[model samples]
Target chain A: MTIGLNAFLIIAGLLFAIGMLGVTLRRNTLVMFMSLEMMLTAVNLALVAFSRYNGTMDGNLFVFFIITVAAAEVAVGLAIIVALFKRRQSVMVEHLNVLSR
Target chain B: MADLLFYLFAGITLISALVMVLMPNAVNGAMCMIVSFLGTAALFVLLEAYFLAILQVLVYAGAVMVLFLFIIMLLDVGEDSPAVKPAKLSIFAALTGFVILSGLVISLFTDPASLPATPAFEVAENPTGLSANNGIPFTTSAKSFGYSLFTKYMLPFQMTGFLLLAAMVGVIVVSKRITETEPEAETTD
Candidate 1:
């Protein structure tokens, strides 16, 4: 079958579902981060597909801002992960309940 | 040709996505995720969103994924800490996700094509990356976008910028504590 816009949309949805599963199933904080990125990628794919289908630049422009915010999120998220690791010497979600540190 | 590229990249994307989830090492999983992101970017190009495709490569794959990799390596999380899946919870979650995805696909196939028939704009190429495409853009749609960004959407844009600044401050504060705690490294003076 030809990979039309519909195909792309389906693939994006599948990716989003897989990402959601990863986020819910996995416990490692780092893997969770990767799953979050996967979610973002799925959204990006959806945006670009809609942009192409509608033949409008609006979705593409929105993707630009999403990219900006995603970058900032990663930088700050990594910093926090590093900080948390320094304190606990572990990156498991279950072991990170102490908010004070 | 397009279908070939799509299938190729889609296969790469799905496989890497599986690797991302199934990998034992967190660092390796993150790397697999990076590959998936690149495949997604290539798919974006095939979809004709050239600008979004470039931004995907530049920002998400290049910056965000790299940051993830850096943090993963920095923390050095490994095989010793095997990630456990809670069996009962995962089965429920997986079933829910599968049902949702099925619904989405069904709805998508049934959805009517009411999408507007506007001509796709040719994305300007600035390989040198020397100039701001924003300031020079004078197309009617480009002008409308600029107006919306500065007028209707101005508040949201400013809020996002402020949030980024706050995140930057937060990162700095957190990293500084790490530097101060290392007394032996401090004693190297």
Candidate 2:
């Protein structure tokens, strides 16, 4: 049997939820950032699925933009994370609470 | 056959994602993320978005994972402390995630009617549902994407370029070694 739209959506939702779980439960900034990227890929999957099922190019096109934005975000975010780690000597989220103080 | 491939890729994606989240070692987690991303790229191929699949492999699996691994290795990241007894907050977070996942799955199964397949989906057995757009044929080829981006989305394209430039400058500035004269420059690196 061919895959259906619903199946694709469910997979997307599952990935998104897993990413969310990682974001909440994981304490490492690097892993947390990776989780964020997972969520973006999940969104990309959903968009491509919708684009395929709806017979339109909008979703696919938007996926490109999303990818572009995600790339920029990852670069900047990683740079900041590295700098933070260099300054603090730790990548644990709880240990980097200077602003909360 | 196609459904089997979908399930296989989906299984790979989901399992690797779970492992990435649950694994205590940062390096292992990053490796799992690579597998998950590759699985996603496979799914993209299944969906016939060949160009997107190629980009997914190149960007996510190749560049991004390499960058993550580089940072992890450069920092000499060690395994997370053993979590023999997880903290209370972690339990709550897991509960929240479970509730969300169950809610989504339940709604998906129970409300298929409200989420009924659209007419476009019904018009073709090919799953791509390649219906004619408003006077424009639709395809997922890289060329078609370029056409739309340059035509309908040109402004946004330029905007994304600017955004990338800003992010690049911001990263360089944030990571640069600053003089001790500036109070904001707290780190020597």
Candidate 3:
């Protein structure tokens, strides 16, 4: 009844692919950001699975650092998004051409 | 039982994630993201990462998601805009993604036994002797986690604190308002 490591890895891969799809297809900045977070979560899952099967704590430690960095990233990324919305009055990625001129 | 739970959690995780992406309403998407995060936390628990499971719920589902919802409401991103037209590039992107996914599936399933074996540690040689009581050495208990964090990984831990501080400062700088009366600094130069 035990799930093997391969199953977890495969699930992680699928999740990562889904996240990549969201990033590529979505136009909204917030949704794109959420997709990026999804990708990170997938990576964390893979690391934990490896850690468990390897009987080590290194992967777990790496996951802890990733979670910390992701929190900071969310704070700053949301702030940037808010600023962009104020300037352009839209959160659509298509509208973001500030550097193009 | 564990296999069943794994499948359940995995199903929840993937479904919610798909919903998050497919839902047009940003609010609904955020809610789905929360559910996905919860499913991920459940998977973490099954992996024996207890601390991370709690942190995932608290940090991702509890805090980060609330932040996203707050912004979604504050901006008032109503359903005013129509769905974006799919450009030609979207097809290319989808094709590329599919190719990558297929490659990963092939390699992973091709040689299942090539996966690294879980490192085995002798119970008698455990440094802290904490596992001696349970007869399971190398278990990543919170105590051992703390031990490794403070001793072996202290530098990276400190660096993460610095990174957070820098992010906080950057956020403040980026979000600060520029008054209309102020001269256009870039143009003036």
Candidate 4:
């Protein structure tokens, strides 16, 4: 029962959808950030699967870059969240209404 | 056996990811995310990407998640408010996700033979010139990965280093506390 490329892809898609749902429904900024990381991981999975199937190092290399970028993103994003929390005393997205005005 | 492992890892990855999202407590969600990353690393191992599998665990599960946990603990974020209902925005997001997923599935199955065959490379070390079982030379090995990273992908690698440096500086700048004397001086002025 070898797993086909399509199966891996479909799994990635489902994981991505779940992450999207979390991002949309969750109001807590930290939870939303975690969901975004889930989405990034899903993409990395797909990239690795394709690399394995295609027998190329390109995809694997790209995955390395993606992971690096993701780490940087998490750093900056969490810092912003911390700053926002300090200002408002909360991490809820609703309290971040200053941008709208 | 490989198929079973794939399913097991996939199940772990998906279930833990869902748990991360659904858990109201940020700390629990971060813990679930760690499990999810571990499962992903296992899947990477199954994919024959051994280097990436280790890196995933080290960077994501070990470092990034620790950072997330530290922030969550430091901020002391509580459970989400129960008052905020799932609004129409959630429905819209769900619909969009469904549509994108269907499109991806359709395109994936549309052309079965569209995927390129795995390219085979001759092994210099093998005396009989027999290709590996996967028909590709040992490209996934750490040596080849490093060689390619330094030679073929050098520029991007350097750029990634710069990006990390910039991100570190940005984090410090953003998270720095405002001094009381500065605010007092501004108020007096």
Candidate 5:
């Protein structure tokens, strides 16, 4: 009944798929962005799993850098989203109805 | 007990992520995301990544979720807006994603061929030495991460500093409002 590598890997893969589905299906830009973050977290989980199983700091360190980059990405990305909202007045991707507004 | 915990946390993560996807209100979705991240952090702890668990809670569940919530509220998107018809291409893509996930699950769980020959040994039981074969032992201690980040990964670490600085400046400039006199607001792209 002990968990193994496959169990962790499968769970990570499932988490990633959920995120992928979310991003594609959601209309709101912010929800899609949150889904993107979920995808990133899923990958980090897999990497941590590998690090634990393989007994390496390399995966963990890679995750460390990923976290740093993700924080920066969130700040910049949300700024862009805010700007989008300012211009279009809607954060739903479908509402961006203009071809060249 | 460990198996039960693993499934519990994994279920928490996947289900919350699903809720975040399907939730109509952005604020509710953000809340679900926090739960999902916390579940992942718990999984990290179960995997023996103590420092990563802490970082996951602090950086992801703390700072990132706060930023998301603030933006969601600032935007104040219409929660009652029904799901717009997703583009046909997007529906195809989502279906493809589901197919891929199902295939992975089948191949991984039902078939022993996909399983590893050797069981994964726990790092807590037998720590691996660095590839450089240096004196540094691989451990999940925060101090160990500091040593590795400083010594072996110095260049990239410094680059991360630059990236963060650039992001800060970009966010400020990108979000700043222009005066009515400036033509910058007029140019739409």
Candidate 6:
């Protein structure tokens, strides 16, 4: 039962769906951020798998840059979360109606 | 061997990813995400890109996820009850997922350009997967990736250093106080 790239891709697809569900259904800002990270991780898995299958390091290099971006994304995102939570005692997206007005 | 490991890690990754998404408690969800991250790193190892596999473990599972956990702990939010998804809505999501998975599986089977795994001589000669093409003496070791990173890819490599530096500055600016404005009343008004 040798592992196939298809099999790994299927797993990644499922993870992406879960992440999408979390993003769409959850109202909590922190939870949404976690879901976004989930999607990014799934993408990284796909990239590495592609790199292996193609016998090239290009995808791997891109994944490295992506990791850098993800780290930066989370840091700034969390800072925004903290600032928003300070403005309003809640981190719920629904309560951010201040922006809608 | 590959099939078994694939299934095992796939199971762990999927299950933990599900927990990460469905757990109402953000802290619990983040922990589950860490489990999922580790499982992904294990999958990378099985793919035989040893350098990438190690970096995945060190950077993602080690540094980044720990920071996420730290934020969760600092936030100190109580567990909120799971938000109920409407039955019809959940079914719609399930259907969408099924469609996407089936599409990927079909494409995987039909694509003619896919490489055959377990190529004997080719695999042995280019064990590190990159250096041989560029006339570097890889000698079937992990250092090949390092050589490529420092040599052929040095520009982007240095750019990554700059990117990290900018990220550090951005984090500091975003988190720090901009001005000592007079203390305003904490009002819900």
Q: Per-residue lDDT of A1-101 in model 5, one digit per residue for the tens?
A: 36777788888888888888888788888888888998899899889887777766778889999999999999999999899888988888777768856
State each model's C-alpha RMSD to the native: 6.5, 4.8, 4.9, 4.9, 4.5, 5.5
lDDT of 2 by residue, B12-48 (tens): 9999999999898999999999999999999988877
- Show model 4 residue runs off by greater than 4 Å: B88-138, B180-189
lDDT of 5 by residue, B52-139 (tens): 8999999999999998888877877838376566678978888797778858775776566777634555343334445554534557
Instruction: Give the Å error, residue A69, model 4.
Output: 1.1
**TM-score against native, each model:** 0.76, 0.88, 0.86, 0.84, 0.88, 0.80
Q: Clashing residue pairs, candidate 2?
A: none
Instruction: Please give, for residues A3-95, the per-residue lDDT of candidate 3 as tens digits.
Output: 777778877888888888888877888889999999999999999887777666778889999999999999999999999899899998767
DockQ of each: 0.46, 0.58, 0.56, 0.56, 0.65, 0.42
lDDT, candidate 1, at B187: 91
In candidate 6, which residue pairs get closer than 3 Å at backbone N, Cα or C atoms, i.e. clash?
none
Place model 4 in a CAPRI quality band: medium
List candidate 5 segments past 4 Å from native: A97-101, B78-80, B87-93, B120-137, B180-189
Q: After superposition, how far is residue B156 of candidate 2 from its true place, in Å?
A: 0.7
Clashing pairs in 5: none
lDDT comparing candidate 1 with the true structure: 0.72
**What DockQ score does model 4 reach against the true complex?**
0.56
Give candidate 2 misplaced runs (Cα > 4 Å). Answer: B82-86, B119-136, B181-189
How accurate locally, in lDDT, is each candidate? 0.72, 0.82, 0.83, 0.81, 0.83, 0.72
Which candidate number maximizes DockQ?
A: 5
lDDT of 1 at B82: 44
Residues A6-84 of candidate 2: C-alpha lDDT, one tens digit per residue: 8888889888888988888877888889999999999999998887777677787788888889888988988998898
lDDT of 4 by residue, B40-144 (tens): 999888787889999999999999999989998898885787776667877687768756875776576446775543432322322222145422233656776
lDDT by residue for model 3 (B80-145), tens: 267666578885877698568857765875575767534333222233632423322345467767
Q: Candidate 1 lDDT, tens digit per residue, B1-189?
A: 777888999989978997888787777787788789889988877776555667777887787777777776677775536455456877687768767875877576546463333444444432221224333221223344555467546787898889889889988987875443767887998
